[model samples]
Target chain A: MFKRIWGWIQRFSSPKHFYDISGKMIPWFAVSALLLGVYGLYMGLFVAPTDYQQGESYRIIFIHVPAAWMSLFIYMVMAIASAIGLIWQIKLADMVAAASAPIGAWFTFLALVTGSLWGKPMWGAYWVWDARLTSELILLFLYFGYMALQSSIEDQRTADKASGLLAIVGVVNIPIIHYSVEWWNTLHQGATVAKFDKPSMHIDMLIPLLVMAFAAKLFYAAVVLVRARNEVLMRERNRQWVRELVEKI
Target chain B: MLKAFYHLLARDLRLAFRLRHELANPLIFFVLVVSLFPLAVTPNAELLQEMAPGVIWVSALLSVLLSLDRLFKQDYEDGSLDQLMLSPNPLVILVLAKVAAHWLLTGLPLVLIAPLLGLFMYVPAEANGVLMLSLLLGTPVLSLVGAIGVSLTVAVNRGGVLLSLIILPLYIPILIFGANAVDVASDGLSVRGQILFLGAVLAMSISLAPLATAVALRITASR
Candidate 1:
């Protein structure tokens, strides 16, 4: 079974194969993402009871939490895929890393904007140089740097290696950014849900947050597939499979 | 093996010195940048002293970045990089020698001149010793880490700006610690902790960055 799964993974490492597979999955992902997102938002906004402390304004957690999670999660995916590409010389891993950058960058921006929106009503200021917030901002810069570095080089192979090295190096900053709030005395609040003992959030609020997190994952999967398909089409344009596929289209 | 190492180092130094005009630009840029803050903001002695460490550190980081591309560019262009690749000694060691040469010319000058600039910025005379020491331990790491960026981008034309974009994020932790070391020193607090942390980072980067840079250069060179 393990060998079988490894074979499948190895086979799918081909851009043509991966593109064909992910293309079929995108519509299902799109529909599920929309449905789950709507349901999550409704549950978060109306069904969830208002926080005694933060009141209705706390509903922003539905968007804010998912966006924050995707920001960190997408980077981890990018880094891991880059590592696989670097280690195993997997072309599809590189393509995946390439596809994920813009999506990850968008989610990071959303996290920052929505976090600020949530902060305004709760923290009484639009911005603070809090550890979590500052690090998240740096995360955005890292994404932009990754994308910029990739695009600046005209040679696709050189661009892959250069941006891959960068992605690997910048991985160090991710943990530091995540933990800066804990390590330093910053205005950012400490862990509410990520804590070890038990989550501090009430079950009602936590459920919608969890649903939105799933929705964000589905959204990312859907988008990554679509983007990866486009990237595959561009990169494999000279190949027989792409030529055939384009002819069919 | 040692002879080959020193020969490459000496060759690079000669080439760099031959284009002394290009080499001096980053230092001049550093000075110009350092001068700008005092002009843009008040030249109040107290305020200048307060902002001096961050300004000097940031400018030094930029200057280091400015000079970093030359660490590999000429060799890469003239096929001397190929010769180095074909050499018996491990490329990582060769890379370390090149980075050391870069630090000697670029980072070392900044460390030496920092005290003088600190004076102009109204840094107290007593903090000068700590400033020099922190920079001494810190700046080599900057060159070492910055070399990785240069190597990765060496194949791309007009990569200098992209190189900065790629490297600056990695440089932040060092900047934070390096500046904090001076800040603590200026405040007359315990500089020991911050200096130790900066040294730890330097040691870690010194060991790892060259190997990473060598791998990156090999990929670029091979392609």
Candidate 2:
């Protein structure tokens, strides 16, 4: 089974094959993302009970948490994919890495805005140099940096390798950014869900958070597939397959 | 190999010194930036002291960034970099020698002048040790990491602003610890812990940044 799956993965490593396969997956992913997102929102806002501490205002977590998770998660995926492309010379992997950047940056921006909105009511300030928030801000800068590096260079192969090295080096800071709160006496609250022994939050809250996380993963898959297809088309525009495919369309 | 390394380092230093006008630009920028705060804000002594460490650190960071493009730009343009790459010596050693020369020209001067600038912001004498030591340990990391940004963008036209856009975020951790070390010392707290952490970060960056920078140079050179 493992060998068979590996064979399939290798076959799909070609940009042409990946493009065709992702085209078929996009609709299915989109529909499921829409359905799951709606259900997740419904469950989070209405079905979930109000927190004793934050009350109704805590509903922002539904958006904020998922956005934050996606921001970091997408960056990790991009960096890993870029690394694969650099090491394995996989063209499809580079396309995925390049395509995922803008979407990840958008989510990072949303996370910051929503986080600030939440902070105003809870922390009584629009912003503070809290470790988690500051790190997230830095994450936004990292995304911008990656995109800027890729776009500034005209040569495609050069851009990929340069940006790949940067991505790998910048990955060292991610853990430092994430754990800056725990390591220091930061104003940001400590972990609520991810803990050593057990989660600190109640079950009612945990379920919605998990569902939203799953929905976010699905949403990322759907959007990444769509964007990757476009990227492949743009990069492969000079190829014969692209010409034939464009003529067919 | 040793002969080539020393020759490159000595040559870079001599060339940089001959272009003394360019070498002084960042220092003058540092001074000008430090002076701007007093003119813009009210000349309140307490407020100035309060903001001094952050202001001075920020100016130092910007000055270092302003000068970093010079690290590889001249060599890259005059094709000296290609010759260096084709040399018998390893590129990483050449990179290290260049970074050291860059530090001598940029980072060392910043460290020496930091105290004078610190006085402009009303930084007290008591914290001078922290200020000097942090810069001593931290600025090499800045030169090393900034070299990576310089190498990556050196081949591109009009890469200065884009280089800063790529490098400034990466510089935050250094800025945080470097500035915070002084802050802790000024407040009569023990700063040894922070200093040690800064040293560790510096060591890590020194070891890793040159390899990344060498890789980046090869990538840009390939085009």
Candidate 3:
């Protein structure tokens, strides 16, 4: 089992191998993402019952919650990839980490923008220093820092290793950010969907939300794989496989 | 290991003392920036008192950031950083010693001078001790974590702005707790929880930061 996993790591790190495999996977992921996203949106907007207290404004959670979850979720992916890259010196893991940063940043920004739009009607203010909002803002800053570090260094290997270190460090701080912000204020509503017991959300609302979240995950998989393909091409432009592919194209 | 750590630490301290005038820059920056709040915001003592903890803590945070150049730039320029890296001793201990020297020269002075700034901002006398105590606990964490940033960027040309961009986000939690402790203390509330958290963070930074810094230095030096 260990050797198979190790062999998988070896094959995955080969630029041609990753490029070809991810190329095949992208269409599948993209198609699923598009289909699920449309279905989820239709269900959430036209099918889910109106929120009793929050009314229609609460429907924005379909986008906001999934985007917010993706923001944190992608950061975890980046961190884990960074760890793998750093520990085993797998170049593909580093590329994945690098590619995920901007996507993660965009998701965080979407979450914040949609959150504030929701806040305008719900809290009667566009922004608040609430724990969830504040920590999410800090998460955005963490993404920016990661990207900045990646770009400033010229050496690709050094950049990967350096930014990988930074990602691991940022992950360590995420929990600290959450706790500190929570201590500073607590105005945000408590968890609803992630509760271990039956979620407070009605089933009609919950199903679409889960579908949207799954769609977002698939969407990220598609986008990151595309970005990782570009990374592989850039790094391997002079390699034999890339040269042969360029000639064929 | 102990001998190498002590020697490197002593060497950094000695070098810091030789250029004592430069040591005052971050302290001056700290004091100067803190004094600006009254002129810019308001001359109202009550308002100043309200802003005191945040003002002092933020200025101190920036001051520590500005002084981070003192950690590795000089050594890198002189090629002594390579020597330190090549030393037979473990790099983590050497990095820790350099950070201790940095904190002593830069972070420690902020802690020493914080009360004077606190007084200027009308921080009640009761909170002064906590302000100093928080700085004492918080600033070393800054140097430790800041070492990781500096080492990562030390090879980049013009890394000053990038350093702050990358480092400040990491610095947020320390700033939150350190500033809030003073905020809580000024209100005559029990600050035991805040101090404990700061202490916990300090402990974590101490254990982990130097290792990260060492790895970062190796990456940077690989060029």
RMSD values, in order shown:
3.2, 3.2, 2.7
Instruction: Calculate the i-RMS of every candidate, to one decimal place.
Output: 2.2, 1.8, 0.7
Candidate scoring better on DockQ of 1 and 2: 2
Residue-level lDDT tens digits of model 2 in A122-217:
777778555667788889999999999999888888888888778887787777545543345342245422222434787777788888888888
Stretches > 4 Å off in candidate 2: A1-10, A177-199
- Ordered by lDDT, highest first, the candidates read 3, 2, 1
Candidate lDDT (C-alpha), each: 0.84, 0.85, 0.93
| TM-score, chain A, candidate 3 | 0.93
TM-score of each: 0.93, 0.94, 0.97
Candidate 1, residue B94: the lDDT equals 92
Task: List candidate 1 stretches off by more than 4 Å.
Answer: A1-7, A177-199, B21-23
Evaluated at residue A62, the lDDT of candidate 1 is: 94
Pairs in clash, predicted candidate 2: none
Instruction: Please give the range of 10 consecutive residues that has the lowest summed lDDT in model 1 chain B.
Output: B172-181
| Ordered list by TM-score, greatest first | 3, 2, 1
- Predictions ranked by DockQ, top down? 3, 2, 1
TM-score of chain B of 1: 0.96
